[model samples]
Target chain A: MTLSIVKNATCTFCGCVCDDIELHAEGEKIVKTKGACSLGESWFKHHTAERLYPDALIDGKPATVDHAVEAAANYLYDANMPLVYGLSNITCEAQREAVFLAEIIGGVIDSHTSL
Target chain B: MIYWGGNPAECHPRHFTKYSLTQKGKFIPNGRKDRTMVLVDIRETPSAKAADLFLQIRPGKDFEVITALRAIIKDQPVNPKSVAETGLTVEQLQDLVKQMKAARFGIIFFGMGLSMTRGKHMNSAGVLMLAAEMNAFTKFVAMPMRGHGNVTGSDMVMRWSTGYPFGVNLCRGYPRFNPGEYSTVDLLVRGDNDAALILGADPGATMPQPGIDHLARIPTIVLDPKVTHTSRISRVHITTAATGVSAPGTVYRMDEIPLPLRPALKSPYPTDEEVIRRIREAVAKKPAWRPSPNGQMAIV
Candidate 1:
């Protein structure tokens, strides 16, 4: 497999968010990483492009993504007090969406900091 | 430099080499040799080996120790017997105060060990007070050693959008701040919430038994690249692309500096942002929960 090299790749394993890593990827797997600590190396190599799990699951059973999203929305809308938690390990863009979701649902939004 | 209640050697492996201690900077030409490192923890961790001095204090004594240090720094009288309860002698505190006063520049980097203990926010306030008091003698600052990727980003985003950092309640059509009441663990343990949408974190593995049980009891939804502990019990689980791995976006450093993420591979899964947007779109089709300035729900 031909290797695709990405320079200045950021590692989001921890709070450091070291952004000078040089990642060498063979297909979907990261084969080598430079300037990343051991923890970061493992984080970069952990995920792959393989579809190992179902796209979505409802009540521990495989379900379509559309079906799962609708179920999640209904539960949140039906609840008297819903919660949107855990912004850690995610992108800032997603975090923004979570805040908006919490507001529309009239719920509480918290992060790992509150723990 | 003071590392209090944090083990950067293991938790943040590149912290010492990349940001502090051993980094060769224009101000400190000799790097590690020119700087003094003082570590304060309940036990000697691997990071202690790198410290010039390691002060082991009794567990849950951070507030007491900090109070004693504040008094000592100001030359206020503190009972030696009471000071001993913190596992450090008055003489040691005095010496530490002297060093802090004489230093050209100093910084205290505290971690969860101080913030999540008995006193919780009070302990963090104590450290901040100590740092602020030290400024009378020299240039000093204190910063928290934030854990988890983009946690600081979350804080920053919440602050800019809601005027508060964490534990924000928008139930009243406006943001409200209250830690013990609105915080995750407290709400979960108290069973205050009926539903939860969890992302990026595994509270099922990290929270207390009651919190975990409350999560299982509720209609929980989770989004992650893999099936996590929380996902197992959640009512719905969606496999989102891993951030900084196959999902390109932005994340913040511990110091609140934002950086772009360059992904190296393409994943089959949708990004968390995409999935969340889809959910929001789905929810919009339903009836309005409350009247707002916009006929449709505001995105902000």
Candidate 2:
């Protein structure tokens, strides 16, 4: 087994933003987390491929990426009162894109900021 | 001076310890001992352990309790037994107020415990007013202990772009703000939205049961790296890179200070910005298009 520790990493699990985390990675996966709370440790350790849903589905059926995008766009376009929510966990760049979508569709936009 | 609602020890351990409690302020020469802290909450929290005085009040009595404390601080007589609704007598509250007046510099940090309870807005305002009133005899400031790393960032972005922080309606081609009417929870609960685009939060796990039920019936689109309760029931789930991890991007600190991120891993899926931009492009056409009967789905 190979072993390596990445230092000065930030734990994204909580608002603490504890920047002193060290991730113990074997190969490409984080196996353990140091300097993290229990919540952050679990977030990094268990967030592996087995826990992720990677397929794009439309109407509960698997669809191509392009089809998914078009379906999403169509959903927003046809919506009389569209709700664009959740931008806190993404990047500023992504948030800007979401804002662009909200403006184009003339929808109401909010995030967990108010939740 | 006071922690109105939040339990900083559990929610914001680092921030509370580093900046509010243990850290030394300019006027308060001692790092931790110089400041006399007061805690007011519905129950005992770990933060209460740090308080010089703990005022535990019944839920929804925050406004009444704070006002009574303010009255006593100003030497205004309040009915002793009536003010005792907070489980603290007027004399005990007056003692805390005396300490507040003695402090060289004081600050109150609150959280959702106050904002979500009854008299929500007024509860926050009352604490702010108390802090301001304390200024008559000493220096005091009030601040909220905001949750989530970038909740403050989300508000700042919306304020800069749309001139509103949250619950903004753009149906008129311009931004309009109405908190209760346009907010996400209200829209979901009222079944007002036809479609929802969830960017990174797990509202399904956090929203009220009614809101969650309505969301399940809607055409929901989710963009997230992890499979959350929101994405589990969403009509479409796109795996996007985590902003501060696999995708290098900028995130504002809880305090609204911007911090640049450095990616620790090569992202397998596209970044959220790229995915959102593609969706925006697809929505830009004036007339919507549909594929032919025989047409097949293609890659984005």
Candidate 3:
């Protein structure tokens, strides 16, 4: 088995965000991790593109993301109560959506930090 | 020279080994040997074992200890008994103050042990005050050991956008800072919220039990690259490419150092930015102004 080494991969598990991890991948699987702590090691070694469900769900029914989002917008638009939470773990760009959605719908917004 | 609260050995193991504790410095070429190490905590941590001095204080007594230290640094006589409430001796406090005053450069790194406990704000202020006082005699600095890959980045962004960081309210087209009233926990537990649009966060696992339970009962939309606990509970989940892994992006460390992410493989999933942009576009669609049944111009 040939190991393909990839260096300078950042571990997003914790606040440290250690960027020195080197992944040794055998085919599509990460075979080993170097220059990383246990947390970093486990994350880089196990983190993958596995999806829990392929189709986006609107009330448990399969639908495209756009369709689901449309449904979500309708629900939120009609609702008297709405909250926009999370957004801390995501990219800065994605967070803008939560903020925008909350403002448009006259809802409250908060992140994981409130925990 | 002093590590208060945080366990670098666990929270920031790489940082401890690579930068703070063992790394060689220009002023101190001998690395660990040339510098003094002090660990202060409520319990023994791996970092304490490596420190030259370990001052295990009573929990919630950080404010007292910090105040006492500041008093000593300012040439004021500190009441040993009062300071000892933190489980340290007058002699130890004196020695610590003396060492800090004598050092060419002194530094303190504190964590949630001080910030998250009772008197958190006071404790933080005490440490900074102590560091500032020590500057009169020697160079001293203090900082918190941050968590999350881009928490600092988030703070930086928040500051740039608003005058504050975290718990910022922009409902009025203006930013407002109020931690308790507008914070996530308060908003959720108080039942002031009904729906949530979760992006890159997991309050399900981290929030208080009440907050978590309430979140599960609400209309939550989770946007992540992986199937996290929050995503599983979300009514609408959109999987995106993982930042710093399948997607090339920039991440910030605890100290706000930006690092470039090297993508190991290209992801088939959409990037977070794209999905969010699409959602925004969808929500922004509004009916144009139209005449009502009576021919009066009214928005529909």
Candidate 1 displacement at residue B2 in angstroms: 0.8
**TM-scores (chain A) of the candidates:** 0.97, 0.85, 0.77
Per candidate, native contacts kept equal 0.85, 0.60, 0.46
lDDT of 1 by residue, B117-144 (tens): 8798889889999999999889999988
**Least well predicted 10-residue stretch by lDDT in candidate 1 chain B:** B291-300
Q: In model 1, which regions exceed 4 Å deviation?
A: B291-300
Cα displacement (Å) at residue A68, model 1:
1.3
lDDT by candidate, in order shown: 0.91, 0.77, 0.72
Q: Largest TM-score belongs to which candidate?
A: 1
Taking every candidate in turn, the Cα RMSD to the unseen true structure, in Å, is 2.9, 5.7, 4.7
Q: Per-residue lDDT for B149 in model 3?
A: 63
Model 1 TM-score, 2 decimals: 0.96
After the best TM-score superposition of candidate 3, give how far the Cα of residue B290 lies from its true spot, in angstroms: 21
Which candidate's lDDT is highest?
Answer: 1
For candidate 1, the docking band is: medium
lDDT by residue (tens digit), candidate 1, A1-115: 8999999999999999999999999997999999999999998888887898999999999999999999999998887689999998889999998888888888899998886
Docking quality category of candidate 3 according to DockQ thresholds = acceptable
Clashing pairs in 1: none
